[model samples]
Target: MYLTVFYALSFCACWRKMYFYKLNMAVRIMTETLIRNHLSHFEVAIAGCGGLGSNAAVALARSGIGKLFMVDFDRVELSNLNRQYFFYDQIGQYKAHALADNIHRIDKSIGLRTSIVKLDETSVTQLFATVDLVIEAFDQAAEKQMLLETMLVNFPEKPLIMGNGMAGFGKFELIKQQQWDKQVYICGDFTNEISEDNPPLAPRVGIVANMQANLALDLILKMRK
Candidate 1:
């Protein structure tokens, strides 16, 4: 009974501040003890670091996820300047590397790994073994489909989250997710409606990405019965 009371206090005080290298061994130990199945041991992978993916990564980082693995091969263009706040003067660099640096810079204690390669059959297999969750941020249908199919077949047990539909014709779903037998959660743009335009708008992307982030965290929390 006394141990339980002490455990409660450990989290309230020191654990909240532990993200940015702020915790000592005692606090980390006690806090980890209090939490259940924390994301500390598992790494979440975000594929496609464009606007939607970028925003989702930031939200997840702030949500106290212990480790993140971001993958993107494209470099920032002047066009990407509008939505990707995660992109800065560090233009021309690969998106994965730039975003990874930004995340680690924002919270030095957060474990962020990166892969600057386009998602493909070979790479998908290579990366899935290292990931506990997958977030699909690719804009193209083909890429999204490939990413989904690969993860489903290879790492069927890993939770996969994806985002689409942030623009054009106007079907805004505040949140949409799923748990396939393999634990796939498609976060945004589940509509069959195509607006002749892809990559939705800034607001739509942000909303869906936010939902994706929430869904990812919920999956991690496993609070849903």
Candidate 2:
């Protein structure tokens, strides 16, 4: 009789576990469906396809962004393999085109427009004018400043996300997100500038990049609601 009772209890426990697992899976599926349905209509432009831009673009693509306009004129180099998301075989390819191809492998349905031209103030305004949002992934301080000014001045209505000071190790807590105004959002430590000694590392760069992607998703979803 004791054996029969133990068997029955064990069966009940297993059944309960299976039931909850199925319930969690159902909820996850529903959430993903909702996100894809909503995000399939929105478009974003990522300026500069280096470490920050490459990582952020992949995150956004996986999140189901409908389209992406990638702009970068630089070619991938062996040194870029340390931080950026590019294979060694793709070293000679333009960053924008290579990134687009990689994003396609992840989600073929995602629309990609690649421009292998350097970005200036006029080009920045022209390329990003129609996109729902713009991401500033430039490495240089001057480029970051240029993009920020152009976006705020030329396209105040659209949202702009940027990464500022993600370099070197430790102090992960220093990485933060700040809203400069109603339209501009910045992410990073805001202190560790990339230089010869303090180079951009994968961990810190990826953190800032994913933060930008997360902010982009949040802003898009909120706007949809």
Candidate 3:
């Protein structure tokens, strides 16, 4: 595995390949240029690749985080035109698939993978074991809960970073999902109390998405040191 040539992981290659990630030399050079020293050693997975998830993907890839696995079920739509960077040509493409392709196009050097499947408690829990950490960026509360519940129960040790209160002018928080311990980080308006309920969405989403990327980068930095 090329990761063996660079990153050493608890999990090894799923299969052997001719060229790692199918990336060319130019991609390898550019990918390494933007990656920080601390992030060069590890991989981080993003489980939701919609508004927040998609933006976070760009941030992480630009920063040169080694690998990413984006997961989403829905196709891009006219509604996603506002904030997402995908093209009008990609209207029918799944968010996860689009993000994966975008990330690869952004930096083929990074080992990027994706699953275009709606996440269930079953698949997510099973998938969590293969990752170092998960960035949770679901648009729906129920889907968010599905990922959170599974990670909290079965992969408690894996860091689960999530966004909260990123809509209706609420604040943003990148919280660590823990079973027995709960710590919240708020970036916008947590005062409404109603923010604790309902779905999140906009500038707040932007705020939270950047924060989540920073949090993931921060964790990767700490792990490297």
Candidate 4:
């Protein structure tokens, strides 16, 4: 009778474990579905497909952003491979198109749109008018200022996330997020502009790029909630 009782207790414990396991799985599936539903409806536009833009676009796509609109007129160069996302073979291709291909490789279901034309104030206004958020990732200060001014003056309601001052190394702690206003957010050291003396390295640029992507996700999810 002792052996019989022992077997019954063991069976009961196994059944209990199985029941809780299935319950946890069901809860996980439900939660994932809820988050996916939220993210799958939001769209973002990334202006300038350089190091920050390329890395951030990939991060956003991996995070399951529903759609992305990318614009850049520059073609990939061998020097860009130091920090940008394009492969060696993609050196001659336009940044926008190459970025789209890379993003699609991560998630084929993500909606992608690309423009090879350069972004000016007018082009910025038109391309990003319908996107839920805009990410400014230009290399030059003038282009960055132009995009920022254009978006703020024209698309006042839309959120803009930008990367700035992510050059050099050993200043990882200096990189941070700054809020210009309700609709404008900037990430990076805020002082380390790329130059002949200070080059854009992958680690710092990637840190800032991912920060922008994370901020974009947080904003979109909170807005939906």
TM-score of each: 0.75, 0.86, 0.71, 0.85
- lDDT of predicted model 1: 0.74
Ranking of models by TM-score:
2, 4, 1, 3
Tell me the tens digit of each residue's lDDT in model 4 across 143-213: 98998899889988899998889999888889899999779999999888788999999999999999999
TM for candidate 2 is: 0.86
Off by over 4 Å in 3: 1-35, 169-202
lDDT of 2 by residue, 1-225 (tens): 999999999999999999988996765434788887888899989999999999999999999999999999999999999989899999899999899989999999999999988899999877887899999999999999999999889998899999999999889989999999999999998999989999999989999999999999888876662
Q: What is the C-alpha RMSD of each candidate to the true structure, in Å?
A: 8.9, 6.6, 13.6, 6.0
Assess candidate 4 and give its lDDT. 0.90
> Which residue pairs in candidate 3 have backbone atoms (N, alpha carbon, C) closer than 3 angstroms, thus clashing?
167-201, 171-188, 171-189, 172-187, 172-188
Model 3 worst lDDT run, 10 consecutive residues? 177-186
Question: Comparing candidate 1 with candidate 4, which one achieves the higher lDDT?
Answer: 4
Query: Per-residue lDDT tens digits of candidate 3, residues 130-186?
Result: 777788878666776777778778877677777654554533343332223342222
How do the residues 1-225 of candidate 1 rate in per-residue lDDT, one tens digit apiece?
999999999977676776535544434443533332475555678889988788899888876777888888899777776677455587788888888888887778888888888889889999868677788888778998898888788888778887755665356644456655558777665664345455456676777788888788767765222
Which runs in model 2 stand beyond 4 Å of their true positions?
A: 1-30
**Model 1 error, position 223 (Å):** 9.7
How many clashes would you count in candidate 1?
Answer: 2
What is the Cα-based TM-score of model 1? 0.75
Alpha carbon RMSD to native, model 4: 6.0
| TM-score quality measure for candidate 4 | 0.85
Stretches > 4 Å off in candidate 1: 1-37, 169-175, 180-182, 192-199, 223-225
